[model samples]
Target chain A: MAAARKKETFWSEPISKVDLQRPAVVPSGTSIIDAVKEMKYNQIGCVLVVGADQKIIGLLSNGDLMHEYVGSTLPGDTPVDTIMTENPFTATPALTVQEALEIFHSNPFRHMPILNGEAIEGILSIRGLMVFISEHLPLEVMNLPPDSSLIATHAAGE
Target chain B: MEGLKEYLTRQDFVSSSEVRWCPGCGDYAVLNSVQNVLPQLGLPKEKFVFVSGIGCSSRFPYYLDTYGFHSIHGRAPTIATGVKVANPELSVWVVTGDGDGLSIGGNHLVHALRRNLDMNIILLNNRIYGLTKGQYSPTSRKGQITKTSPYGVLEEPLDPLRIALASEATFVGRAVDTDPKHITEVLVAGAEHKGTAFVEILQSCVIFNKNAWTEVSDRSCREDRLLYLEQGKPLIFGEKRNKGIILKGTKPVVVTIGEQGIKKKDLVVHDRHREDPVYAAMLTKMDYPDYPLPVGIFHAMEKPVYEVELVKQIKEVTALKGRRNLQGLLRGSEYWTVSNKGKTIKRSTGISSLANDESKVMDERIHALLKSTDPLTASLKNTIGKIFYDYDYKRSKMLSPRDSIASAIALFKAAKIECILVGDAKRLYGILSERDIIQNVVLTSVDRDRMPISSIMRPVYEIMDESNSIGDVINILSISGHRHVPIRLKDGGFGLVTIRQILRFIHDTVEQVEKKESEDK
Candidate 1:
């Protein structure tokens, strides 16, 4: 099973190749509570806040909602922009997962927006990135040749 | 699970809060209907939450005995959304008025509908702001006079039903507050619906907009003006059942039944299950005087509700990917762990090499200052337990993490203290020393407005303990190069000690020695 599993470099793959969230987008001036509801309802990781022209302005996640609303005294009625991380650090669609790793180093972003010029392509969550990398990394790093290694065998499926 | 009789009663949902609405207000009827319908939900009273925005009708939550939140104006839908999303099991309800829901909260309302969350929304269309005494509302009729539009309302009035229809709300209905049975029926249906249910109540504001809906809702004219929609039935109304609606190529034509070859078969059949929404849209647009008003469910269709989809998606994603916890996200990176012999071993791989900037040296300095401290320092031993108490110590002021770094820096300069304790309005966080600020803010050139004081706070363990003598304090000031020594007070508060204070003590002792030596000479 270990021999059957394919090994891949995390940095070499473009972020677009990995599943990026087709974000549930909400308009600016939207309340934080409503924005979070949109994210929860759609099961979307992040709700991208867009301007009047539908350009990305901000983004809110479960973590942001927890910190900004659940932990704070601010009412849920506060506008999305008020709690949303405005103009968050974004990566271009052409950027690789390795580049994403480097970007995370500086920005510490768990969820990074992928932009194709002015328009948003999708969102990349650290969970998705790490999970994908973990599947590929476990076997090769162990350096044990093929056959029934329990951890490697379990991670054999793509 | 709960017993039916234990948590199910109309009185169980009644709140102790004083009912403050004006007597004869339409809100009273809607409130009664909600309380009655709640018992039928079969959920515990604690599982129910009524959220309302600012307005006369927004006060509905306060009168409810169950958990409720009186939220901001025009933001009830948003608040209710939090309550529902955080705990989908909770039967969340939104109570909002015409001005609060339509005018100020229109964005939240439409989005909530579009999302099709599993929650009931009771929109009270009173046509005026009764709380503010008298003001025209968004649903107020065109050419109506009020405090805001005394010259008569110029803009065409908004139709709440039409808005709900366009937003693709799963359940949309209208009922009159004057009719308790009808209101209860609609409210129960809304509560029973698995998706977002919007019911607009045509409530009469006795003081501000008196009899706004009385023309259509009055007993004498109700049979003719009001049209009760029933599934798979012909569109018929009027006291004698004489009036019937027939489609003239999409336009509804009100004609007399059993006259001019107009039979019941010729009437348009109400198709609640129609895939197309043109009929529902038209039905919602119908108004009194010209057309009989629709006072039942205009549209109720099955759609995958938002909360359900969210939960399903999360499960699917979690299965596909892996679990990501909150703490990993907070400190800004995923903490890698390896299972060894059934025990998890955490790896200390930081987020990229970029974080190791020039601050690496300062980080080492900080670690040394914090870790190298022993229980007893050579500078002072017994002096702390006895003599140091005689010296007056200044307690440092604390700042909340929410405060901007710029304001904290300005405050630090004015306070003349080398450092300040950083925390909330209460509670003592780590101390923020001038050295920590100079290293992170000035040397690194970070954004002060965006940065929080918590980011550069000196750890509590690094602080000088009350047991340390003045000698130990001086040693700390020299080694750490911090003018201010934030010490823990005996009462569990934070106090500051400065090099200037120590210098003053030294100068006074030297003066005393010189006078004694001169007298002996």
Candidate 2:
């Protein structure tokens, strides 16, 4: 008989796979306030700033809003291009889970946009990593390993 | 002087960790009660252990001077179970909140109680997820407005007391955070109980779930709206003490005293230790606007503690057989060996398998030479080689053909790691973490299940062209406090550069200048 098993599936399986096609574009001249409002309406945390030719330029997250407008003295209507993260990390659809995990560990941001060549594809989240971790690793190994094992090893060495 | 109370002072119980929660959080009252009751029990601080699930209340462990674990979400009971069974002498307490305990951790809570674990579980029901900012919790009343529930909650809320009694909890009680004296009294009683004691404390989340329970919590309205239950006393609540509950047929009926010619004896008396839970369940449901809400011990009974029973069973079995050594258990597993270890196979893909390919091997030798001569070109070549070789077209298509999911996960993890640099974002324009996904989707159990990546992908912070001046990039990074910024290439595609990379670039430039000066000298 088959042993009972907790099914393993992608964490993103629940959320619709995000599309990066056409890349949600905002003009560089658009105000950060308007960008933030667009983000809110879209129910997203960041927006891509684009040039007139629809070429990708910079990225802005809610974090940018907090620093530039909420926390700082800057006006909300300040242009998004002034505060957007310029030239953000890009990944193709062909990237593996291990490669993506390594990038996340080495880089910053809990989420990143997927790019297909110059165009946006979709986004990924840390929850996906957690789901993967939950399936691959035992509960005890998920965090720091138990301290008793270290003590036992020390005794053996002594 | 010889009691546990003598060994502990209110300050002695407090840990050195700074209290970062908002000032008026109900956690303060709960903490005060635990500290006050601990000394009275005369247990040494070393003998006491506190386990907590995640939330504002989960911070209980950090503030306590004793040994504690601020564990992951909704898993405190499981951890506390491990701690208790490992060392039965330690006095264990599990501190949880409405969201942490009732919503996510409900399964663990019920099982622990049913097994009758000897622990005092102080459930602070603030009715909102305070730590995550005002999201409607499982305990948040229907129609309550919250950060996630802009239109108000349409789902029914779980009643903790009813849940506990239904689960056959050995001891069940309720208390108010504002009533410090009563809270302390109930806590001491809960701790003294031999079996699992589930005490639900009606707490206030002043900011997010403001006035959520105002009708029952207000002091002026409490006398009329709240019903304080005591063993052997008539069920009564009123400003003049004129109102009381009496049995009409099988149901509890609220009535006025003296005017109806009904004496206090005619009123329903609370029997806390009753073996049957039917009456207790009824009392929990009585939340009348004009009647006092019931508080105090609703149920109490004796049962064998799960830990003690487990240990007892283990000892009995061990007596018949020899005790097992830790070393033996660690290394005694059976092993298997495979025989087909060194066979080589031909590759069907464009590249020849290592065993069959000779020209491919010569190419690697030349590649190594190029790597040593030009490091940058070698790195780029190596990246492309690795990407091409590792690509799995079939699995990639099945999992995420567009690669949007993986990219989003990468970006979210990056943002969370930089949390110290970026404060909380109350709103989401694009996604940053899995928490954002769970909060926005899974909690509501919405279906985005099989749709393509483009359907869910939100526009995240933009990437700039590599031609963009380093100074301009630095200005954006410093202002946003983002360490990793995606660099958009002029032609297309992108490259990621981190703050560390920029700093390293500057350091490298300075070293180059110093070397040139030394050579000139």
Q: Interface Cα RMSD per model, in Å? A: 25.1, 20.4
RMSD of each: 26.0, 24.2
| TM-score for each model | 0.50, 0.49
For candidate 2, write residues B1-521 as lDDT tens digits.
36657767777788898877787777787888888888888787898899999999999998889999999899998899889889999999999988889888999998888988899898999888988998989898888888888998999999999999989998999988778888888888899999899999998888887676767877777778878888889898788898899987767888888876988888999999999998898888877563457889999999888988998898996897657676754444322233476333222233322223454455455334323232211222222212212332111111132434334433344443231111112222232333244233322323444433444534446444455444445444544434445544344433455544443343344345547769999
Which candidate gets the maximum DockQ versus the true structure?
2
Pairs that collide, model 1: A11-A98, A41-B306, B15-B65
Q: For all the predictions, what are the DockQ values?
A: 0.01, 0.03
lDDT of 1 by residue, B244-269 (tens): 88888978888998889999999888
lDDT of all predictions, in order shown? 0.73, 0.66
- Using lDDT as the measure, which candidate wins? 1
What range of 10 consecutive residues in model 2 chain B has the weakest lDDT sum?
B392-401
Give candidate 2 regions above 4 Å deviation. Answer: A1-158, B326-521
